[model samples]
Each structure stands twice: as structure tokens, then as C-alpha cells.
Target: MSPTPEAVDLSQQRALADWLPGRLAAEQPAILVLGDVMLDGWWSGSIERLCREAPAPVVDVQNRESVPGGAANTAMNLAALGARVSVAGIIGTDDAGMDLRNQLVAAGIDVTYLLDHPDMVTTTKIRISSGGQVMLRIDDSARSVPAEALAELAASVRSAVEHQHAVMVCDYGTGVLADPVRRGLVDALAGRDRAEPGVRPLLVVDSHDPRPWAPLRPDLVTPNAQETARMLDLRLPEGQERVAEVSRHADALLEATGAGAVVVTLDRDGTVLLRPDGVTHRTWARPAAEKQASGAGDTFVAALTLARSAGLPLTASLDLAQAAADVVVHQPGTSVCSTAQLSRYLKAFADTALEAGELERQLELHRAQDQRIVLTNGCFDVLHSGHTRYLNQAKQLGDILVVALNSDESVRRLKGAGRPINAVADRAAVVAALSCVDYVTVFDTPTAAPLIRQLRPEVYAKGGDYTPEMLAETPAVEEYGGRVAILDYVADRSTTAVVNKIRDGEGAVQTN
Candidate 1:
């Protein structure tokens, strides 16, 4: 049996968080989003009384706004994440279609291929909400696109795919991606020599029912739990059981969807990625929020497509997609995870204390990126200017500076009683907050030799008048071809000196 899929290593998570923003900025991958396009309208107001005609609460509508939905939302998410995005689909020539087109243009998305059909009704969902809860939804959509309109969309998609780096098929069972469009997509993809490496436009399919598009042979397909269950014609149990059932049918799902891989997203249960070779990778969901917004799946697909198009490993792309989805779930309404928001979320991980294993994994990722690692250990019971200055100097020596703090027990063992004014957790937090420090971890050892050997940082830094002979970890560093560097120490900058001054009350004010 394949081993259980573990969460993405914390270090890798940190590395992806740091790498994605810069990569997206430099590449600005052009992605074509095709399939159903719609506008989502929100009518929010106060429900103070019941309506005379019915028992339902009467909503005094106070606000009305519209945003992209379905495939358009997916395109919006791609645009938000710094991708050069264009949308292709069928919409009506009505006001709703015009509104949707305007919104897409305003968000910097190219709508050249978003065709308007005189006979079709623009797919629009108007949801009435009150006090942050959805009350009712009214949908307007055409059952099918005219054959001529479908032909036009297929032609546009064929041409658009030629210039794009990635194509996202967001099929919502709206007939926008009809038989003609699907056939065109298959021909276009096949003509691109997709089997070869470094193809220009990778194809990703996100559909309500993906089995029909099996001929396209997409690189990735994202189907939520319910969608997966429907495709399989079986009821999947909740939680891990659902994940196991999906794993057992991984090969079947691959064959059914004709995708290189399938990611089955389980709301509040994270996601499970299934591949053709029986390899599965899972990402655990963040703690469930009391209430969450919608369209996180679209956010996931957008990030995943962008990451994959940028040549990130498939597993890493999955993790990045999960992180983006996590960002949007906590927000209200249909939301998108912007590049800045995702960066901030990932940076938050750096402030928390990591175990030795996690820290080592993080360092390995740094090494992979050819970044220099600097390691330093101390008992920062109280943060002061001296500590900050020393850390800044240490950071200057390398690309990533890791601060290791002595655990409370170790601090007390070394300094005797009444030492370590703050606990290791608190100390790690303070040290991590320093702009120069990239990561923080707690160590209980009397010396930092174990950590130095495990992390194998390029530079083992210390502050003060200490030579290689004075440090216990010098041999450990030298054994691994690493070097020890001593940074300049400011006068009267010791934590001991600060504690003594406080105890002596030298800086205390005299009361009248």
C-alpha cells in the first residue's frame, strides 16, 4: 500500500510562500480561462419583519453589487494573483452580460474572446442576503448556446490558446463549452505536442462534470467532493473515510477524467491529490471557521494553474493552491486570494516556533534555492537594541538568518534560578519579529552543536569576543565545511547588564 499522504513540510511551505510572489511578478503568466461566464449579484439588507404575503422574513434591501462568477471568477482570481488573464465564453447581449464584461475589463482581464450571443441569456446568480447570511438566490441562464455561437467560441479559444501560457477550462454545465469547443480544445492541445516538456500553454480543467472532457487529456482536474462522488456514482463518507475512498479509485478517476492528476477538494477536510501512478499527496485543512465565503475553489484552481505554468513541481503547486484557498475562506462573500494576502499569510508562519525537524526541512529548501543560511543561538529573555543590532549584523552575513532560542529549562540550568524572564515561546516570537530574522526555533540542549550539525547552515554566527576555540559548536561547523563568524558586540548590550540595571533601580524615577 502507498504510504499515507502527509502534509507538505513546513519549510517547503515557507519557501513556496517566499518564492511565488517574485516568480509571479517576473513571469506574469498569460492564462486563458474558458467555459461558463456569469455575474454574481449580492443584494444585502436588514430583515426586520415578516412579509404580509408570506411567512418569510421581509428583507429591506440596502445594498446591491455584482461581481464575476463561475469561469469569470476563476479569471478574476488569476488576474488578482498577477497573471495576465483573458476570458473566453458565451454571454447574452443583455445588460447583465454588459455588466459582467465591464467588470472583467475593469479588473485588467482581456475580454476579447468573451462572445455575446443575441439569443443567449447571460448566466447570472442574484443572491439576497441579510445580516451576513444568504436568504435567497435567483439564477438566470440559457440552457444551451446556439451552434453558431459555439462555433465562434471554439474558433476564439483555438486562436487564444496559441498565445497563452496556460488554459483553464471552467465548465459549469452551462453549455458554453459545447461539443464543438471541446473538440477544438482537443485538437489545439494535441497539435501543441503536449507530451514534450516546456510546452507553452498547460491545460487545466475545473468542471462540475469532467468525465465528458476526457478526450482533452488535461494536465490537472479539480473536482470537489460532491462532484467527485457524482462522477463515480457513489456516496463518499465524510472526513478521512472520504479521502480513502477517493484514493482507492484514483486510477478510475484518472481514466474517467483523462487528467494527468486529479485534486479532490473536501471543504473543511483539506484536499487529496490523486495521480495515475498510485501516488497520492494530501494537504490538511486549516481549522474550520465559524463562517466562510464562497469561490475558494476557483482561487485554488487559479493558483495551482499559475504555479504549474511557472514550472513548479506538482506537489508544491498543490500546497500553494491550498494556501491560497485558505486565505479566502476566512473572508466574507465570494473572495479572491491576492498575491499580497498570500505572501502575508505565509510570512505569518515564520513568527511561530518550529521544531528541529521542521527547521531542518526549511533550511533544506533554502539550500535548494541557493540561498545562504546563517544560524545563531541565544536566550533572548528580554529583547533590546543590542539584540536587534546583533541580529541585523548576523542577517547581513547570509540570505536567511535562523534564530535558535534556549528553552526555559536550558536557560534556568545555565543561569541558575530566576533566569529566563520570558518563556521560549515568547522569546521565539520576539526574535522572529525582527525583520532580519527569517525563522526561529527552540532548543533544549546545553549547546547548539546538535542544531548546527542538523541544520548545516553555511555560517554559524555568534556575537561577542569569542573565537572558534571558545565555542562548543565550532568543531561541528568545521566538520561539515561550515565556518564560524563572530559579529561585533555593542558595549553594555548584554541581557545580564540590562537585568542588573533594572534590579539596581538606576533608571528609576524619584517620586515627590
Candidate 2:
């Protein structure tokens, strides 16, 4: 249960970010993500231009996009976290479903489980925004995959789990985790058929059911404070008694669910973690923006899976998740956190190419490396100690740290005119050249949420003043049992400072 090298964060603005890489180095055994597969779409533009054709502001159109949602997100996260992903979820035989499956395959997640049921409309959630402010939201998806499809999915997952390092059962409560199929998925991983004994395949379950938990006895189950309370049926407050009770409840819950360990995330208070090794701990998130929590939990649990698969102990796994979560929850829209983005908040690991031109290629190349992916994004205008510390720390979160830099266009849209002082290529290189960075790409969105969701790193990271509970990435990161948190800020170190000093020409400091 002790924190391993991967979880050790040199930045310590919050939790350890060192364990990420080693934790993600595992073979990324073919993971069977059996659950929801969805599409998350977003429309971004300016309110100033609403609809010129109507009385509404002429909303200047920026762009439209989509990524995996629900169980699919879980699958993508697994892939990002360095696991060879083979997802089994039903999608309609429509364009959206096709897009979802295609994206998963393109991102390196096996789509063997992505069933195309003609009766269903692929699950999708669309969010529209302008100038960093969310203006509207849309939901277009079904509650469940077809019954027959679910049964087939169960069989597919059962077979995949045989060869997988672990089977992640992502129950989003959205039809995907139907009681019947969900239970079957867990049992399959538990070696019910006496299939491949001694392998002790890990069963990672992320769901809203306390009753179902015990029946499956998964290796690990991640639940937020509120969800923990509901699942454990406790009214415990935040205190020693609460910790003890929560642990006991979690233990009982663990026993009931047959899970080996329980990691309960306590938002701002960091995380109240429990491990089978008889250890418990708490960690904090970095200080960051406090707005829409689109994809925090997904990032957190994703990090955990990656860390665990990479051989990181529970302590290191939790620590890495906390730090990664800190990085993701501070943005305005559905965001993402790449290993590179979180890398600044990680450790002084290895660096990767981050130029805009090389990003896509880098992504493809890394996708071929057979490693879990930890993704995070940011502007990184002027590199600073905090940034380096964060990057190095993030490297510990997964095997391959991919940083998503803001494209020149994205910078202009997000930071306003004259933004991204460092062009996409320059910014990418600056971040990529750092020993801590792995791979770098360009994202033209306000936040890395979308990219994080797509990349679905094992852990998502951010830098700021928030605790784990206070961390914005909490809910989303935890959704798929991923952990989230902020990295300790580098005290007074900041890119803004360097920028100011240089602008004044009275600065005595060095520039990257």
C-alpha cells in the first residue's frame, strides 16, 4: 500500500505524480471494458455572434467534436492508461455509433465489444459553449444496449478477460450496467468457469451499486464520498470516526462485493483510500478553476487502472490519481488531462515531441507502443518550475505521457487575441523537450477535458490550489474509477511571472 516510485510527485503541490509511468508500464493486457459505449460531442463558438440569422447573437461558429462516452470512455481511458483495450459495448448501427467505434479503434482501443444494434441511437451528450462559458447542452443516446447484444457482449468480455491483465466493469447506471449483464461480467472475471486459474485477473469495477459490489468481489472499486455513503449506507461525517467507519464500511462492502480493495475519493479533502494491504491514506488536489465537472472521475479512475496495471501499489496508484485529477477539474468544458499535460505536474521523467505537426504522428506512433496512455492538456506558454514539477510528476502516472498543447487557433479561441505567446509548435517543443514530457499534441479547445476523455489516461492531473475533494476532476475522474487531483503549485513559480519580468525587461531570471 505504500506509494511506489510512480506515485512520488516531485512537485507535491498536492499528491505524488511520480508513480504514473511505472504504473503504466505493464503490458496493458487486453482490457475488457464491458459496459456503456457512448459519444460525447461539443459545439463551441462565440455568443457575440449567436445566430446572425435570428435575434440571437450571431454565435461565431468555432468547431464541433466528439469522443467516447460512458463505458466507451472507460475503454478509451484504459487504452490511454497503457492497456490494450478491447471494449464490449453496444452501439446503434448509425453514424454516431460508427463514429464512436471508429474513434475507439483509431485511439488504439479494440472495438470487439462495440456491438452495432440497429435499434439504438448511440448514446451522445453534446455541450455548446462560447468564450469559456457553457451556453447549452444536448443529450442524444439510449439507456441500454440491446438485451441480445448485452448477452453477446458478456460472452465477448468473458473471452477477452481470459487474456487480459484485468477486466474493467464500468457501470455508468446508464443501461449499460444492467443488473443481469453487469453481474455476469464480474463473475466472468472472477474465474467462475475456473477459466485460467492462478492468473488472478484483476476485476476493477466502477459503479453505483453497493449490493452488486459484494456479489462480484472485484479487485477494486472506486466510489466518491457521496457515492460511498450511499453504497455503504452510512451517515458518517468527515473525521477520525468517519474514516474508521468508512474503512469498516468499505471493508464490509468489499467483503460483500468480493472486491480486494476500496478507494473512496473525498473531493476537497483529497481521497480516503483503503487497500487490501491494510493501509489507508488521504491526499489533496491542486488549486484550479471551479466550474463544470464534465470528466473528472473518468480521469481519476483511468489513472488508477493505468497505475495498477503498470505495477504501482495502491498507495502510488491513489497518489497518481489525486495529482492527475487536480489537473483536469480546473477547466470550463468537458475536459481531458494528458500524460504530457499532467507531466508538468508529474516528475522529471522523459520528454516526447510536442510540436503541433508531430503531435498526430506521435500519437499514432505511441499508440503502437503497447503502453497505457496518460493524457493531459494546457497552454504552457512559459515553462516554469511548477510546470516541470508537474510534468515530472505526471510521468509517474502512466507509461507514456502525452501532452495535448493548445493549437494556435485553440489558443486564440481560449486565451483571446494575442494568446499562446508560444506558437503551437514552439509551445509543444518547449514542453516536449523537457525530460518529464513523453508525447505532445495540439488541442484547440478551452480545456483538455475533451482530449482527456478521448485519451482517457489512467490518471488526469492539474495544477492549482484545490484539494482532492475540492478538485474539479473528482466526479468525472471517479466515474470510471479513475482518480483526480491537483499538483502542489510551485509556490511563486509561474509562467505569468516570467512573462511579466521579460515584458518589463528588468528581469534577471532565465527564459526557456
Candidate 3:
């Protein structure tokens, strides 16, 4: 067997972050979710003391909330991430079923395929929490899907998956994904793929049991460690060997199931995605001291499917999915990650640093929205009022301000040794955090001419009382119909003067 490959070190997060907004704006990809749908109810109250009857604490219920769970939860996540999602599954003709449908509809999911069964009871997991801690979980579920109901659901699944960009099989072992229904879904997807060739919708499976799904030949299957181990009939690996062990087990899963890829989620350790070509991509989990890992897996698979449907590569999709899971695990209850939350989350990680290509991708999207770009360059070694005012002026010139800083080597060559008080990463972060600056990137050149050539901004901005004739990038700026704006210099604010003053003990150099 081939050794597990290292995770793809591509800037997938940055790429996905740059790609998402435009994809979301251009089109809302449709996804069909099939399997067991459930309602998750939360009852919360304050627990003051132990109950007088049993050992359990007495809880006075003050608030009651219900949300979609199981396959429905997956659909909710896809919808929350801006996918045009539709749900196809069996639900009881009860209050929980009605509530589940309402919640799905409220989240902008199509419930046309959500069939109601008179004999079945809507699956529900009611969690009671006291003082922010879950005290008890009461599960109300029906294990059997009537044959007629299953046939109806299979028909619904077939029709729903036809027009969707992707299909998600979210099986919780709830009998909704029984053998017959699974085979029907598989046949339906196969027919569609055969009919459309390269245009067929991608199929992703996240099942409690991986065996039944294996024959479906899903494009991707997300299995937790135990599920993957169970499918392979192997024990979970322990300690330092976990990564390698999981990779090996994922290999077995792929061979056994014939899945195009297998994503083994190793709880807090992170996730490993194994492709058929013997490539394994790993992503480390985002850190959190306290975790609410209840709905993290659903969040992950949903984002993964959505990103893949949006045409991002598997690496970018995995990055976006991992980031989405990280966001959900830090929140309470079985919650879905919203698009705004995801956008903010990606921004937090990508803001500190970005490559020029990623920045250009972002710029393209911004321009698509008619947002004019403003480009500026500087060492920004030690931020001061001069830099702040300069960046502020640049921001006024366009809808977005992009600051491209020189690399350490470039800075050293231009300003001599020991000139940049802060490293490039640190400087980029500092500039990125400023309110006036919209994006930050680093260029390994003595001048920003190359970056200017790539960006071709509507306005090229400069500060510190420099005339256009003195700037070498003037022709490059004018080449793209970009006008140069030179802002007034802030008196007594030069970094050199500040360093000289501090060197001579005239005063302390203030950093802004």
C-alpha cells in the first residue's frame, strides 16, 4: 500500500475565501438533501438545586427552541451557506414534523420533497440544558419507514436530485436510508450521471454506517473515526499513530466502498481526506478551549458539498468546510454556520496575510460589484500618523484600499540593514487591521511596479510629499488609466526622524 500523502499545503483557505463571494453572488447552486430528517429541540432553564424526588436537578423550563437536525440539519447548513437547498426525506404527520418543515422553510430550503407519513413519528432529539450545560437528552424517534412511504421518498429523491448541482445523503441510521431506498437513490444518481456525462451532479455521503453507502459510489464520504474503523472492521488508532492509521483505514474504506474520496474526521485532532489517486489531504482543527461539537460534522459536510458544487477544487472545498466546522464547534447546540459567520471567519484567518494572486482574485470580485480599487505601496516598517493619514486618503479615492508592502529582502535592499522594525507578516497584519485598509499583500521587489502591473488599480496612491516624476511606477499606473494621488505629508512623522530622535535620546518614538 502507498504511504499516506501529506496534506496539500496550497493556500486553499485564501483561495476559497476569495472565490466564495463571487460564486454566491453569481449563482446559488442547488443541492438536494436526502435521508433521515429530525427536529432538535432545546429546553433551557436555571438549575438552582437538586430535585427533591430523583438525583437529577430540578429544571424550570423558561425557553423552548426547535431547529432542523440530522439530514435536515445538513440542508439547513447548505442553505445557510447560501446554497439553494431542497430536502427529501420521511417525517411523521406530527407537530415535530410540522415544526421541522417550518424550520427548514424558514432557512430558505425547499420542502417540496419532504414527505409526511401518518404512522411514523417525526424523529426528535430534545436537549435540556441548565445554566449553559446540557443536563439531559430525550430522543423520540421511529425506526421504521413504511414500504410505501419509502417508495414515495425514493421517487422524491430521484426527482429532486435531477436538477440539483449536488446531492447529499445524510443517513443517521434512521431507516429512511434503508437498503431499497439507498439502491433507488444510487440508481437515480447513476442514471443522471450516465445521461449527462461530465455534467452530472456530485454525490456526497455522510452516513452513520458507511457499508450501505459504499455501493452508492459517492464522490465523497465523510465518516467519523469510529464509522471509518467500523467499515474497515479495525480498531481506532491511538496516540501519535492516529494520522497514519487513519490514512491507512481511509484507504481500506475507499477500496471497500469504491468512494471517489473519503474524509475521516478525527474529532479534535482534525480531518484527513483520502482520494482515489492515493493522495491524502489533512487539515488541523482550529483551537478552542471549550467545544460544542454536536453539529460540527454536519457543518463540515454541508460546506464541503457547497464549495465543491460551486466548482472549487477539493483542496479549497476542504479548507472552507474545515473552517465552517471550526465555527460551528465553538457555538452552542446543533447549530448551522451562516454565510455571514463563514465570511467573517474566513476573513479573520486570511486577513493577517494573503498572496498577490489571492489578492487579485479578491479584487476581481470587488470590481465585479463596481467597487473601484485603490492601490498603495510602502515599507510601513513602523506605523505612524503619516501612514495612517496616507492610507485614509487612499481609501477616499476608491471603494477599497489595497496596501502592497515590500518583502524583508526588498526592504533591506532599499532601506539598508535593520531598517524594517517589524517583519513583513507583522507589518501586513498591522496594516490589515487598520480601518482604512481593505486588503494587504507583500511583494518581493524593490518597487511595487510588478504588483501595480498585476493589480492595475483605478487609482495609485502615494504619500509623503512625493511628486509623480520621482516615482518609477508612474508609467505603470498611467498605463492602466490609473491616476496618481499624492497625499500631504505629516510633519515630524518620518520613521527615520523618529528613529534618530530615539537614538539621540530626544524623545520616545511613538508607534501608531
Candidate 4:
């Protein structure tokens, strides 16, 4: 039987967690971010009284911070994800522009193509908040870019696209990506050599109105529900209804945006990818706070673009992008997901204990990727340094490590009454929390022979110094051309010894 959607999602998430760190480390793809660039300002303070001038709360501004917004925010996120990023946009020669430029430079983004227009006012949005509630927002982006600035920006776009692996267009209905600029982008995309398969640079559009750039034939276009509604000129319902509506019009959206795929982001409901092949891939959103910072969509686009440029599958790239968006939604203000932060967030998926069926399905995926799987089983009643060392050693024997735990009933039957001071759930959670263990599952069987035979991992590891003939599971392993490995055992580190010592009150207990 085919795996369920939930099972597939779990398997994909696990694979991404294991694959991202290495993939990000090996390649630093160059990406060019083009479109409207703005400065986001946050002014937060305490509010104790109403303003005398108007019916509004008075905010005693205590702290003020500024960060990049719009297309520049996308560039910041790309840089944080370890991409060699360059930004092409028009910004006024004002203080906000200078601050945005300095921040982008400090973040290691190439700003050579950031054109400075003397007459235009740099786009800046400042939010005033007190006690976690936004009081008012002030915008300073009224002037339009002159013809001279637009010409310069168009030239810069043409030049920047030559060396980039991907171009991410972030259009907020701003004048920076004017007709001239878009023509330059389209001409540059058309001029690229396509003699070799997969040689053309990817074009990803994250615009409020994507129809204008349809001529460029973007590889991907990300539109939220509102933007999708605008494109279709139909008011969408809430929740799953909206998703269904978008799916029904997938062909129209594809044709309208001229994109190979369209990813419609449904906010808390997560995102869905629609393709011309009539295949739709959906990623459910992980748990996140209701109140999130701005620029999460920018983070998603940055990650999606980077992943695609790195040659990841479309579905996998969407999953990674959703993961990145999930990470930044929990922070305050405009935030970016760094490589280390994204890696850690992905690794957190390993903490979930899977059922035997799900575990087997996930193992199949790992095996198909040519990753050797190592299986080990034990009570793991009380996790300690000894158990950690053993698991680490087992992980070194293979590319993926699977730890099986004895259920409560099985633990009691094997170790007698008062055994397993910790329950099976607790045991599995603790073992899965270890970095060395990739997957954890519970079994009620008296022996692990059945699981070993079912999984047929490349190696079956045991911590004790026992010969293969002494183990019941050894035969099961050998029957399938799998080897049995014995890991190093730490003496005097048994769980029984620790429990006995605690019962005897022999050691000083530490308190938090």
C-alpha cells in the first residue's frame, strides 16, 4: 500500500533534516533579488495613557530598530541561508536608504547593483507599537523613480542576471520594477543560452501582481490567497475551501502567471504547489504562534529559490521553504532564518516517535537514497552518558540510525516488577532527542527479531560485547545480508546501578 500523506510528510521532513546541512555546506549558489526595496522600522514602547490630541493610545517610544523589507528582505533571508546573494533595485539617497545599504552590506549581501536615485524617496514603513499592539504605521514612499533611475536599474538587472543561478523578483506594486526594468529582465532571460538541459537560470516571481511578468516564464511563482484571488478576480472562501478553489483554477493561474509551478500560500494552513501536470503537492503548516513578524513570505521565497537553484526537487524545495517560514514566524519584527537556525529547526522533527509502519516507510526512503540504515533495540529505561556514547558509535557505522524501544508491557515482562522507571513514551522521547538517533519506535514484542527482519537494516548494532551467535536477532540480520555490529559498552554506567545508588541515597543530588 502507498504511504498516507501524513506518513509521506514525516518521511520527507526527516530526509530534509538529514540532507539540508550537507547540501547547504557544499554549494553557495549565487542569487539575484530584483524589485521594490524598502526599510522596515519598529518603534516600540510602553503605553500608559491616551493621547490628548486624538482618540489613540500614546506610545512612549523606548526602542527603535530598522531592517530591510520587500525585495531587500528576501535578499537578507537568502544571505542568511548561505547563498551568495546580490540585490538589484532602486533606493533614494536618503538616511533610510543608507541604513538599508549598511545593513545589507553587514549581512554580506552584494549591493553593487543597488541604484541610488537622488530625487526619489526611499520606501520605508515604520510601525509604532506599545504593549505588543501596533498603534499606527507611517509610510514614507510617495515619489516615483525618474526615467534616469529606471534606466540605470534596468541596466543593472541585465548585468546582474548574467552570473546568477537564479533571479527572485519581489514586486509590491512599486515603481522600481517599471516597464523598462521588466523588459530588461525579460530580454536578459531570453538571451541566456539553453543548449544544455537545466542550464538556464531559474526565474522565481514573488509579486503582488504576477501577471505583468508572465512573459518571462518564471520557473515558480508564489502568491498568497489574496493575490490569487486578485489574479482570478474571484473572492475565495476561508480554509480548505480557498485551497480547493485555487486548485480548480490551477490551469488558469499557471497560464496567467506563465510559471511552471504556482505555490499558493494559505497562511496558517500552509502552502500548496500546483503544476501543469495536474499534480498538486501540499505541505501542512507546523504549529506556530498566531502573531508573527513580517517578512515571513520573503523568507519562504528566498529559501524556495535557493533550494531550487541547488537542484532539489520541487516538492522538497517547497517543504524546505515552508520549514524556513515556520522558523521565522515565531520571532518578533522582521526576521530571517539562518542556516544554523533552519538546520536546528529541521532536526527537531526527529524528536517525534513514529509507529512501526511509519518507521518502515521512512526507512525505505532512506535506503532508496543509498543511505545505510543501522538498527538497534533496547529498553533504554534511563538515558545516560553511556547510552549516548553507544548510540553515537552505532551512528558512525551507518548513514542513518534507528532505535527501537521496548513497550511498557514488554519492559515489565523482561525486567520484572518495578522495572522501566520511565515509561515507553518517555524512553522513546529521550532516545529520539539524541542527535545520533535518526528515528525511534516502540515494539511490544519480547525480542527485536521481528523488527530486524522487517526493517532489514544494513547493520544491527548492540552495545554489549556479545558475539553474533549469542543474539537472537543476529540470524535475522544475516538472513538478509545484513551484518551485526557490537558497539563499545561503558562499564559501571548501567541504569540499575544508578537507580540503586539513588535508592541508597549515596550521592549528592543536584537541584535546578
After superposition, the stretches of candidate 2 with alpha carbons farther than 4 Å from their true spots are 1-23, 48-61, 190-193, 234-248, 275-278, 291-293, 330-332, 348-512
Better of 3 and 4 by TM-score: 4
**lDDT (10s digit) by residue, model 4, range 350-428:** 4477888888999999888999999999988755446765776687678788999988899899988988776665566
313-415 per-residue lDDT for model 1 (tens digits): 6765666787788888888777788889987876666449988999899888989998999999999876555666577668767778899889899999998
TM-score of 1: 0.68
The TM-score ranking, best first, is 4, 1, 3, 2
- Model 4 residue 363 CA deviation (Å) reads 25
Pairs with steric clashes in candidate 1:
none
lDDT of 2 by residue, 256-295 (tens): 5567777776665456667655555545454465575566
Could you give candidate 3's per-residue lDDT for residues 1-512 as a string of tens digits? 11111111112223334445445534578999988899998899998888878887898999998888889889888888888998888899999999988888888888999999899899999999877788889999886778889888776666777878888988888798887788788778878878888877888988887767777778888888888778777787674357688776655788776789888888676677787776556555664666434788899899899878876667546756877888898888789898888767655634466788888999999999998999999888765556665675677677778888888888889889767766776667556644456788888876888889998899999997799989999999988788988887777788767555545656544432
Looking at model 1, report the run of 10 residues with the lowest lDDT sum.
1-10
* Order of the predicted models by lDDT, top scorer first: 4, 1, 3, 2
What lDDT does the true structure give each of the candidates? Answer: 0.80, 0.64, 0.77, 0.81
My TM-score estimates for the predictions, one after another, are 0.68, 0.60, 0.68, 0.69
Alpha carbon deviation, residue 64, candidate 2 (Å)? 1.4
Q: Which stretches of candidate 1 lie over 4 Å from their true place?
A: 1-16, 194-200, 354-441, 446-512
What's model 3's TM-score? 0.68
TM-score winner between candidates 2 and 4: 4
Better of 2 and 3 by TM-score: 3
User: Which 10 consecutive positions of candidate 3 have the poorest summed lDDT?
Assistant: 1-10
Quote model 2's TM-score: 0.60
